[model samples]
Target chain A: MALPSVSRRLRHPFPFAILAIALSLSTGVASAKLRVVASTPDVADMARQIGGDRVSVVTIANPRQDPHKVPVRPSFATRLHRADALVVQGLGLEHAFIPALIEGARNGNILPGAPGYIDASLYVKPLQVPSSQNRSQGELHPLGNPHFNLDPVQGKRMARAIAEGLERVDPSGADDYREGLERFTTLLDEKIEEWARLAEPLRGVKVVSYHNDLIYLANRYGLLQVGTIEIKPGIQPTPGHLENLLRLMKRENVKIIIREISYDPGVARSLAERTGARVVPLAVMAGGLGPEGYVDSIQANLEALVGAVAESGSP
Target chain B: MSFRFHVGRESRRGGAALALILAAGSPLPVGAADSDATTLHEQLEATQREAERTRDEVAELKRHVADLEAAARSADATPTTTARIAPVNADNPAVSFVVDTALDVSTQSSWQSIGYPDGWNFTLKNGELFISAPIDPFLRGYASINGTSDEGFDVEEAAIITTSLPWGLTLKGGRFFADVGRLPHWHDEALPFVDRPPSIDRMIGGESGSEGLEASWLMPIDLFIEVTGGLYDAVGSENLETLNDNGFFGRRSFQELNFLGRIHGYVDLSDTFNAELGGSWTGIPRDEERSLWALDVTLRHQPGTQSSYQGLDLGAEWMWNSQRFTERDDGGAIMSRIRRRRQGGYAYVEAFFARRFSVGARFDYSESPEGAADRARTASAFVTWKPSEFQRVRFQFDNSWGDQQTNQRFTIQWTAFIGSHSHGFAQR
Candidate 1:
């Protein structure tokens, strides 16, 4: 065509190179693609599956980390900058800074009023919402228990909700997102039922746990969550709390104490010795010393439950 | 959160705590050796009986405290309405509503009493029609009119903060107060352990109003260091330039640089004292036409728990600024001429005893080094009560014994945080 245009086109021959770079970045840049910040490992896994390679996912707390007491990090702000969406459990189960962190970030879509925000609890049927958390009694979850991720069915549904939200903001790859969500939910539903059956022997068995975070899983298998080892969410039992717990277990003849790998086993062990109750530590979220994916997580927990029940014969 | 009582057991024991140890240790017979463990069990059973009685009292006390706090929070917003109890049965869903309103009436008698007692005082306080629900997210708007004895019809502060953010951050906008430290904060909300520390107030000259926007950044630091900052407006008054106050074509106000910075580093020194050092500063144009600097430090200590005296928090600061002048009643005269040295600094020490009850005092002295202006000194005392986390009241008195003459002030303040309210009824 024109002399200047021909020379400019000849000088800039990197169009193909630029497209390839964008394609590479599309997968490598975790913050820009559907950036997902999950609160726990299971949610992170779910987010990964639902969004697939199109998303950049980061979980704030580890699999075995106590979700209630998880601390926030400085880089979380930087993560927020790249995050296009935030998927979190919102039933009042997470640590304090959850609200503070969201309030202090760069991502505009994740703000409370924006469409890019998704609180997984909204899609699930939250349980144990308390009237109030007045310090006089015990801890409470004013918006229903926030630990719904433990329930496989609810977890799958939440994944679907998350996927839908991701698709709405980003319509370009909607089919891939829906397919990914479908595969995850289908696998989850099958595994959940199998786990329930495997845990059949432990159904209705009296149990004591480190934290009351396991009510959903317990209810599913009829494992009665008798009492918690801790009097408060983060506080270790005072001499008074331990002493009172001992008397209650003695009177009830409760023989099993549930434990999580994250907490100190010393107190629970001593309490077990004093009361003759078998101590059984249970996992609260998926990927908690279990398998990686949703179904694997359920299977791992089922096996653990069977072993816990067999190890500690029911009264 | 799970508590059950056998009908017969509640009657036998003083309370439902008789099975304290037995309840928590109702173990599944997982192992073998513990079956014949009757001796330890019996001993635990006996001690736990005693503990059960004590547990009942503690539980009731805690429950009572919780109920009282809930009632107090409810009362703040629903002043006159009687608190309705939950329905007799759980079948009926529960609903209770509350509305809170604030009335502030101020009086200022100006020296230039031109025609008639030339001072301005009226209902310039914040009036908010608050509607709240325990189970929902909310929206709030405020009407604020500030009538300074001099600057009439000034819009002080107003805005609504919401709970929806994509990355777990709360978002707020709409003519809100800029996050300028001790100076532009709610005056009555200041900690009265002593007079407002000069380094945070007088030394750091500031104004009110936020126009552009702000996004509070909560940097993800490690477990020890907590860091947060805000991107906000540097100038106050929507009026960028008054000399040409055309609402549409008005001269743009000084372009606000990134707002001030807040960095706090807290280190636990030892068993007795916990030391916290904080530094705060903002970028703003000065009256002398130069950008100024405001920095403060806090050093506090509290004897370990065993000591008869509970604890203490003592700290001080230094803020000096000097400049050349331009013109902006909004106090935005940039210090581009930093040579004039329009600077001043203040040193203050404030300590609180027992956390609950104590005294705080500070002495502030400032002047424009060349004597082209005036210098001042002030002493003060204040009492504070934090009945609960969301409720606090304070009483203060300030004596300016210097160039500004001796004047004292009395104030009472209250705050209620109705975090997120959902409005299903309105949208329907």
Candidate 2:
């Protein structure tokens, strides 16, 4: 009988409603740490670098998992549901599952146009944006290649975008985020210069990557990208394509073949053996280079490339 | 510092003496003066030419800025009115078409074939067109139209779902598959097997599509849990027909409707392994009520590497129903009152041992709703090859034996899709 009476009072406007609202507000303010969810591991690293102690970051896709086809797990949606902001590598990198996760999360704060939705690609001038799309050309990112995270120089821009998103959601931590971004960019500048020096021997060196993933890296290091092993973007290399690539590699005198660690190494190794080129396995995302995150990952990539070039006895 | 200044002064004095000697030498030649005048004139002409170029460049810059400002003004003025008026195709939804075809051969012609034709028959089974779009900030709309060569066409699902409901609540209204069990929710072409399990076909009376309203709540907790409740005008048509023919589980008045409730939970056992469990119930309330309850579970393991070629799946579902039956005599007098309970289930395991190939087998057992003594069991095995994400071909063999005549079937099915086609993340 008392429960019925209480419910009846709730049905109408009463002082309890105001009290409940006040209690909720107090609880929300008491434990205010911004929750950020990133679509990929590298973006998560950038978020952590910029968010610092003011925010907690969770990544939906594992570092070693293929970004193009991340398994839509239940925990990903749950994490997104509680996130104050959602950071994405963008440029259609997470196209397969991000939309579904966002819809499943049912969080209005992180919708596409909402303040908490941070698209890191907005700060990047993307490469290889298709002029027109056709399925015959294979899986295409209409906006551009979504692998800008592999470019160390673009890491600074991604961090700035993440910092701005954090400041938008948590104005109280704006100064902290700004300081974190400054520190990250300054360190990145020094590392970029160091890597450039280390990459001096790779200048104008001919190389072939398994996919279009290494285009930005080649652009940064002055490596001449002769051709890719795959016939099309997502398609596996056909036998005919491989034969053609072998001829092209030999003709171009390609010294190194860069293959992402996540992909199967058999094809890359086969081509390397046939063409007499060295195969260098590299991870496209963070966490594969140990615990130091983005800086260490880029440094390791540079070292691997330089080492491969040296082994090939190339200038 | 003073010594450096003395050196600088001495150097300057020497330069002055050199200049004085040059000036005195210059007085010895009118040709030198003429040459100096000529050099000064050349310098003057160069400065004039440079000024002219600067003037032209400034004019070009002004023109460019004016054009930019004009374009900005035009853009600013045009958008307020045009932006408010949406484009003709602004609301155009994502549309996709899928077609499924099959060749089915059965040993016994009298056996029930569900939706497929019996005996040696090749069929243009069906083609489906799906359309979906966000209706507004708060609503999403989805519709699917299915057409078969023999059945013409029908609307399978058309629903408006709430997107911005508060407190983890989503409301869906219109015709849609009732959230009763896993198999009923999937389209035929998307099913793991060539067709639905025999248990689902017998227990749920085929696809449980209905005109209803459903509300689902994603519980705010650490784990993934969703609770859903639905009210429908009626259950499956076959269910109504079967129960109504048997005078068991049909409603007498328009006020009577079917109600359903389901709870689903998912957990990640590891980075590469996950499991999902769901329980569902649907019933019509009356003095002698009719109700069906189902429990389903699925476990999946997908390695992070070579995910396409390395994966395992195991799934099973069991359903039980309780109902009251009324028997009548030829003289229109009640003969007896009967109560019946029946149960059935199916289990299957599939593994991807190669990049584009998978093989699986299923065992199905179900007691007929027609009578207590009527029952059937089936064993089926299938091999599937998917050339790409959009295309699949499967060959299946089924053998059934029970109260009905024993039969065997061989079926080959091909399914293909075009355009943007996806059933969302929860499809798997």
Q: TM-score, chain A, per candidate? A: 0.84, 0.88
Writing each residue's lDDT as its tens digit, candidate 1 over A149-222 gives 76777787788778887787678879988999998888877777777678788777777777777777777778
Score residue A240 of candidate 2 by CA lDDT. 88
The candidate scoring highest on lDDT is: 2
Q: What is the lDDT of residue B108 in candidate 2?
A: 80
Those runs of model 1 whose alpha carbons end farther than 4 Å from true positions after fitting are A1-33, A68-74, A94-98, A106-108, A112-114, A130-139, A229-241, A259-270, A278-283, A288-306, B1-157, B160-177, B180-202, B205-291, B294-320, B323-428
lDDT of 1 by residue, B1-428 (tens): 22334323434552333354355466656453264245446656665665676568668867998999999999786868476677775433222211221222223332111111212223222222223222234333443444433355444545555444433344446555555433334332234432334433333433334544544433232112222234444344432223226665333344323344444433446534444344444443322233344444445454422121234545554555544444345676543433445444444454444323455555656553343255555555655554432334455454443444344433333433233322221110
Q: Compared to the true structure, candidate 2 yields what TM-score?
A: 0.83
lDDT of 1: 0.53
Per-residue CA lDDT of model 2 for B139-247, tens digit only, reads: 9898988886666788878999888888878899987778887777787777888888878888887778777799988766557777788988666746544554675
Residue lDDT tens for model 2, A201-220: 98899988877887778788
Clashing residue pairs in candidate 2, if any?
none
